[model samples]
Each structure stands twice: as structure tokens, then as C-alpha cells.
Target: MFKHLLPRMRERSAAANRPVSLSDMMEEFWREPFGNLSPLFRDAGYPAVDVSEADGVVTVKAELPGLDPKDVTISVENDALILRGEKRFEDEQKKDDYHRIERAYGSFSRVVPLPGKVKEAEAKARFEKGVLTVTLPRDAAEAVRNIPIEGA
Candidate 1:
């Protein structure tokens, strides 16, 4: 029954560098019931992250809707910033029947490479409106500067 979907998905996967995880496929299945409907974005095992390094600081922003700050963890590992979290889907009313569940929910872990060395202990993190922002101070000693040389 799903023969066409497999090949199409495979072709897409081959075209894109990032491999779609199983959770993403499951979410796609649950949300996209009809073939004609537009397929929702799938971010499996990782959230959409934007990382920028400028003015002696590194800033990372991640989109994690419907997730609490307490459930998230930020860490610096091997010169990379790591973000891990889980968005739990609660059944507030057991009597309610869901017609369409388009929101993707689950645990995710992602790593962003730093542009330069950062002061790990001085990092600041903030979560507001289901978005996570992490600010890291860059190490001054790691900054590159040209050294003057005398001709012999």
C-alpha cells in the first residue's frame, strides 16, 4: 500500500544531506493522512538551531515549541555546544479524541560547532516562549591577531 511513499522518501533522503530519522517518518505518517496534503516539516532527534558567532560572543537559538525549560539541558563538549531536551505530550483530557496531530513531540539532542573558543563557565542560557537561547562569551586568548616581524 505504501510502495510509492518509500521510493519517494528515499529519493528525497538521497537528495538531502540530513537523513530523516524514524521519529520524523512516524510524525509524517500520523500527520499526513492524505497524499495530497502538504507534508509538515520533520525534525527528528534535533531541533532547528541557529548559531552565530560575532563580537566576542557566540549565540545559539533553538526552536522547541511546547517544551519546558526544566526539561532542557545545555552543555559544552569537545568544543561544541550540545542541546538535549524532551517535549512530552500530555493527555490532559483522556476523553478528548485528536483528529489531527501535526505537532512533533519527542526527545532531541543536537550539537552546534563553535566558531571559536568559548568561556564555558560564563555561558548564559534563557528559555522564553518555547525557544532556547544560549549566549557564550568568547575566550580573548583564542582571538587571532597578526604579529609584526622585523626583517633580518
Candidate 2:
């Protein structure tokens, strides 16, 4: 039966460390965003994000439409860039005035692990035209830090 195959598919995906499927990816996009998964799933939610590093600077750009700049918060924790925000959908002033509102409303958090250390205090973030961009300059003294292998 199809029900039996669904669970088996999930088990295989977990074992292989790969995304379930394109159809399954769409399902996950509707259900919950994949913050725990790889960055390939960055475009899975209401506001998708794009991250890149260049010239000793790491930039993170997120699509946040219909949101005020003050409604969002950006912070750094343990060398990781954290973006947190909420979006709300309000239809009409009176409930009886409108039929319904199918817009999605909720809070989202994105934690991006930096490739190298960043100066949190010196970082700059700007929200222009619904796009949130955070620019982080790499640490000067320690431009490149070696990540240690565990149980290798």
C-alpha cells in the first residue's frame, strides 16, 4: 500500500542523508522550514535566504516581503549569524467585512554557521526593498581558523 511506502521512503532518506524528494521537499516547505537541514533548503519557507562569502566578508541576504525593518532582529551567537523575525497577516478591520485570509503568518529563525569568525560589533545589517542584507567582515588577526575534527 502507499502508506507502507511512505515510511520506508523516509527511512531511506534519513539513512542516505539526502532530501526526501522534490514532492517531499514541497510538502516540507508547506509544513515546516528546514533549518536543521543543509543550506540547499534555504528557499523552503516564506522568506528564503541566500548566503555568500567574498573578499574577507560574508554576506547574507534574505527575502522578507511585507515586513517592516523594525520587526526583524539580527544577532551573532558563538560565531553563528542568527536572523529572527515575525510576519503577521491581518485581513480586514471587521471580521464580517472580508471573506477570508489565506495568508501565512508566523515567526521564523535562521541560524547560519559562519565559515570563519566575525566581528559581531562591527557587522552591519540593512533592510532595503524587502531584502535583509547582513555584511560581516572576517576577523583580522585570525582570518582563517582551522576547524578540528572530532573522533577522526
Question: How close is every model to the real structure, measured as TM-score?
Answer: 0.65, 0.62
lDDT of 1 by residue, 35-136 (tens): 434454333336888888788889999988888888999999888999988888898999999999988788888988888889999999999997899999
- Count of clashes, each model: 0, 0
Best by lDDT: 1
Q: Which 10 residues in a row give candidate 1 its minimum summed lDDT?
A: 36-45
Candidate models: Cα lDDT each: 0.82, 0.81
- Cα miss at 151, model 1 (Å)? 11
For every candidate, C-alpha RMSD to the true structure in Å: 9.8, 8.4
lDDT per residue as tens, model 2, 3-110: 768777777777878767665566667786666577766556546777798998989898988899888989999988888888876555655665676666789887
Where is model 1 more than 4 Å wrong at Cα? 1-45, 147-152
Candidate number of the best TM-score = 1
> TM-score of the candidate numbered 1?
0.65
